[model samples]
Target: MEIADMFSTTTIPFSGITLEQVVLAVIIAVIGLIAVKVIASAFTEMLGRTSRLSALIIELLVRFFSILLYVILVLIVLATLGFDVSSVVLGLSAVIGLILGFGLQDTVTNLASGVWVAAFRPLDKGEYVEVNGISGTVTSVGILATELLKPDNTYITIPNSQVWGSAVINSTRMDTRRLEVKVGVAYDSDLTLAIRVATDLMKNDERVLPSPEPVVVVTELADSSVNLSLRAWTKTADLWGAQWDLNREIVNAFADAGIAIPFPQMDVHLDGTH
Candidate 1:
């Protein structure tokens, strides 16, 4: 007999399912899974090539479609096993409703919030952001959660609802940032000279933008020292470096200009009888 006929005629003990049917079902499952993966990947690649959609949106679309494909695949598998597709779908709907009724409200909220996050796009991948009091580099935005990688290599996962509800501070979203460096000099020091030195330090730095013009102003006169505020605008990427360099340069510049940055001190007097 032909292999096809042999498979058709064979049956497993205690079960009416034929070997051919079982083999076909397994093949269908394997092929369905591969098709799902391939289709999802193709969709992702197509979306990735477009500049109109954000990364977050592309990811959400891919995930949503992949899940849909998996559900269809499950239904197909069940049908292959001789189950009624209509009844199965109805049963699944009832089961889902029951699950939601029990306590999946938070899960539903997360999914809705995920959609809002994709639409609004307050933050994007690769951005340094602080959300819900946790600061990190955004790695991805998912259906249920947003993932981040902290500076110390710690991984963080935050719920979508919290991410959407909280204020998101994206440090690298803007092209430039204003850097403020405050230095306190001795009260008796020449305020004019100190201001000039600090202003020049900011202007000399190549990273600082010249359009706004750097400003150094006497902000406060405290008991121990006079506070000078130095404000300069620089590229966001250069903000930290410029601030550090300006701070070090300010100290040396003040010393060279004969300006003094005093330490806190107090004078005590005792009676002669003591």
Candidate 2:
């Protein structure tokens, strides 16, 4: 008898709804939640397979669909339980709008900015960029933030709103980059020999592009030395490595060629007038 009583349908107090209706509502809600989860997973997988869609866009789509599906499921459950689902939906919409407008304004702003970023890409994943004074390689752009992997392998997260508003400098956009190296030579050193040594050093480097024909010229004549400006063109990918290698090699080559690389020195005759 007790076992049968446990399954018996009884009227819930205060409301016209039966206990069986409440139980059915709970069961249906659970099933709907599971269905929503499955749908969300499928949609996310589909978006993931599409190469053109950005990560932020995919995330937003999945979340939007999930929320819509759950809201519909809730309304169905409420209607089945003999409640006025229409009034509930209207009230929820109004309340949610007010809450979002007042409390979640930042979230709304970030979402809007995220959409802008996905549509007009100022930066892309795997590219090196400087935004908001922090320079790093971008890993992913998401609905709320942009993730960056710094040189030290630490991760940085910047809000989408901040990123969209700040200055963005993308270093990897160009195919070729110009490298400038300045070296000061002793005033007595043969300026012609210094220029030739620097130019040959740059030309010999396979990483340096030949079309530009690396230039070496006197940029400034200082009090103690003459500064030779060495400008070379190289593929952007090889610029840093080439710059480091050429800088060291130029110093050594200058020494070997008897070109005197000068240091800051001030010559003063004991000023008796002072």
Candidate 3:
């Protein structure tokens, strides 16, 4: 038998569909996937340039359209392979409905929660938030899950249902944040001078906002030390930096001013009689 004859006679095992038809279907699928990818990228870039829509909406739209394109591609492939596309779709719909009815309640819940998340705009992409006790920057809000990038660069995917059900703390949503620094000084230290020094430190820092006016107050008088709380407001972006710098500055300032920050200590009493 000639090579061409062998090629022409070969049929997919058990099925009447020929090898040539399978190859064509495979080609169509590959091309469709590539096209879908390209279109999705273009769509994402286009939406990304717009300021009217939030990042969460952009991600949801891109994900939805990509899935839709892939579904259409699958139907096309089935049609090309001589399968009844309409019947396949109807069968798929029935199968999906059955699956949802059985044990896919969580999936449905996640999808519904995703819709609520998008609608309510609780947390958006690029915002740092704590959702359900997990703190991270939101990378994407998808149909079923919300992706986050942690401070340590670790990635987290929380189900949308959990995210929506729990409280979400958005740290970056506000323009300004109040930073509180607590330092304990020796009980003998002058409380008035300590407050003044701490207040001066905050006032000198350029990151600290002048509007609210930083205040230092004696919060507690412990057995070993008097605790001072320095409260200052700064731009949200500058909060961490201002906090770190103020802490270091306060330590040095106390040292320069002869203010002793006391650690836990106990004087041992030895019985002379023993």
Candidate 4:
């Protein structure tokens, strides 16, 4: 018998399904699978172009889209095979519910919080942030947890729930940071001359930003000295270095110009009668 003739004559045992229909179903399922893979790859590549999208969000999106595609493909295949879609969906739901009910509450919560973190983006990798009372540089933001690299080079992982629930402070988000240093000069020294000296030093420093202009003013007048406040702005990367360098320059300049930074001292006078 010819192959075509045999396929036409063949019938599934005790059912109306034919050999030809079975072959067609197999072909359709194979094509559907191939289409799903191609679509998934394309979708991922498209997401890669969006620079603002985080890796966590990209992973979540790929999983969601792939699952949706597979579910639709399954339903189409079932309908083509003369099966009731509603019945199959209902049976599948029951199985899924059973799995969900078996202690998946925490997992679901964490997954949801992970989605929230990826969507809102309170902090990004490489940013210096303080969250949940812990300060560190964000190393990675995973679906379940966020990794932080501490100043001491130690890694700390915090669950998505805790990070999302607590307040987040991102210090590195700004382009520039302001730092203030205070120095005390003897009360008798010329305050105007002192301010000019500090201002010149700050302006000459390459790290100091010139737009806002550095400020030097007398903030306090104590018993022995006048407290000078030097407020300057620098790029975030140079903040600490600039502050340290400017402080040393101020002290040296003050000493060269006869400005005395005195320690706390008091004089006592006594009179004796014979």
Candidate 5:
């Protein structure tokens, strides 16, 4: 007998599946799955070998093939079982649709949002940004959630809706930032000396930018102290560093020049009745 005639559904004399036939079908399914695995692996390897290709592109391609491989193998196995799968799935499509609507609506929504984000790129990976109230570096943008690496080394997986809905503040976009520190002096202190020392420190500091020149202005005359505003510019990358260093410089500079950076002191004068 020819091989096709033996396995043909119409020509086969077998009434029902035998132990041998069941074993053979299982073996065929296993081999089919293995073949799919091999093909997908080869495809991924080929894509990976391409020059200067984006990692995301390669990753998406590989994932697609992997998913396709599994699906194809599943269909082949179902076909081997002598069942008409298309008719069955078509009949059940309505029930499947309802199940997906109830159970996966939010998941599907996020996936749509993620696609929008990927296309628009409101946030790129490894960039620092403040989304909503959480400030962190974007670690990964995904279908359902965007992962962020927090300042304290914690990982936050926020949903795509939250990311797209809120305002995003990109702090690292600027090259330099302004540092405003408040200093006060007693009314008796020499105003000229105080301004000289603050401005001198600002000009001399290497981290502080000299373009705008630092403004050492007596901003206000308070009840107890004359408020001096020390406004300086520095590289945005060095903002916190310059802030900590500049305060110490101001104190020492003022003291060395006999200019007292004052503490609030209230004077009470008793009436002559005493």
Candidate 6:
């Protein structure tokens, strides 16, 4: 009795089914898709709030699975219409794969590279990175290309191959970096006093790092003056600030101490009246 009842369907059952059933099935499939989207969003949010790696994996997986689900639902609906789904799918797979392979070869290359990038992490988004002779801040790290924001506020996009092929320089990765400044004083001025002033500037600056310490050397004696090369270490973020401040302090100190900052002094006794 149970088996007979299970197999049974009225000739026109539950509001007399017609093309309306097809429309309703289509609506149900649409509803299923909406539900899939909502669920996927929830899953992503849950994972993102907890573990970043898990969130990334889940995001990628969701994209792949959403397509799979759509295909499965389509196959099930086609089967209900008494179509040969197995043969159809087999034929479609080869044609789809061939078309995709030819058109998306570059995309596949980027996809492979993207996977490696995510795993290895040579550079991260928002870092001030220099590569291939171009210096810029990394705005985005995508599968196909990287987006950089240049110092002049222009956007640049470079292919992933170019980035991975060359040496990547990360400028702001460390806390401290070295600063170099050259000061020239007149040969007539006291060399001892000039050195003392430059050395004192570095010693007094709060921004200057002290472990490796600051250096003041009489690097060269030029025709016009003695060049004093000053090198110091400072926090990376404070580089420009320290440079500006140091220059200002040095200028004021030299003026106060009556030291002469030299320039080219050419003596012409009318070289034989040219």
User: Against the hidden reference, what TM-scores do the models get?
Assistant: 0.91, 0.76, 0.87, 0.63, 0.64, 0.65
Q: Quote the lDDT for 209 in model 1.
A: 100
lDDT, residue 15, model 4:
75
Candidate 1, superposed: residue stretches over 4 Å from native: 2-6, 9-16, 48-51, 269-274
How do the candidates rank by lDDT, highest first? 1, 3, 2, 4, 5, 6
lDDT agreement with native, every candidate: 0.92, 0.87, 0.91, 0.86, 0.77, 0.76
Candidate 2 per-residue lDDT over residues 1-274, each given as its tens digit: 7644654556677887876678889999999999999999999998898656876567667777898998899898998798898899889989999999889899988888888887778988888999989999988888788899999998999999998998999888789999988899999998888988899999999999998889998989898789988899999999989989987899999999999887789887897897
Query: What local lDDT does model 6 show for residue 23?
Result: 54
Candidate 5, run of 10 with poorest lDDT = 9-18
Model 5 lDDT tens row, 28-53: 88898788778878887887786444
Best by TM-score: 1
Model 4 TM-score, 2 decimals:
0.63
Q: Is candidate 2 or candidate 4 better by lDDT?
A: 2
Worst 10 residues of 6 by lDDT: 3-12
lDDT of 6 by residue, 7-74 (tens): 34322355443443455467767877887788777767776777766322454556556777778778
- Candidate 4: segments with Cα more than 4 A from true spot: 1-44, 50-56, 59-109, 222-225, 264-274
Which lDDT tens digits does candidate 3 get at residues 73-171? 999999877789999999999999999999999999999999889878999878999998899999888899999999999999999999999999999
TM-score of candidate 2 against the unseen true structure: 0.76
Which residue pairs clash within candidate 4? none
Q: Give the residue spans of candidate 6 off by over 4 A.
A: 1-106, 218-225, 264-274
Poorest 10 consecutive residues by lDDT, candidate 2: 2-11
Query: What is candidate 2's CA lDDT for residue 15?
Result: 83
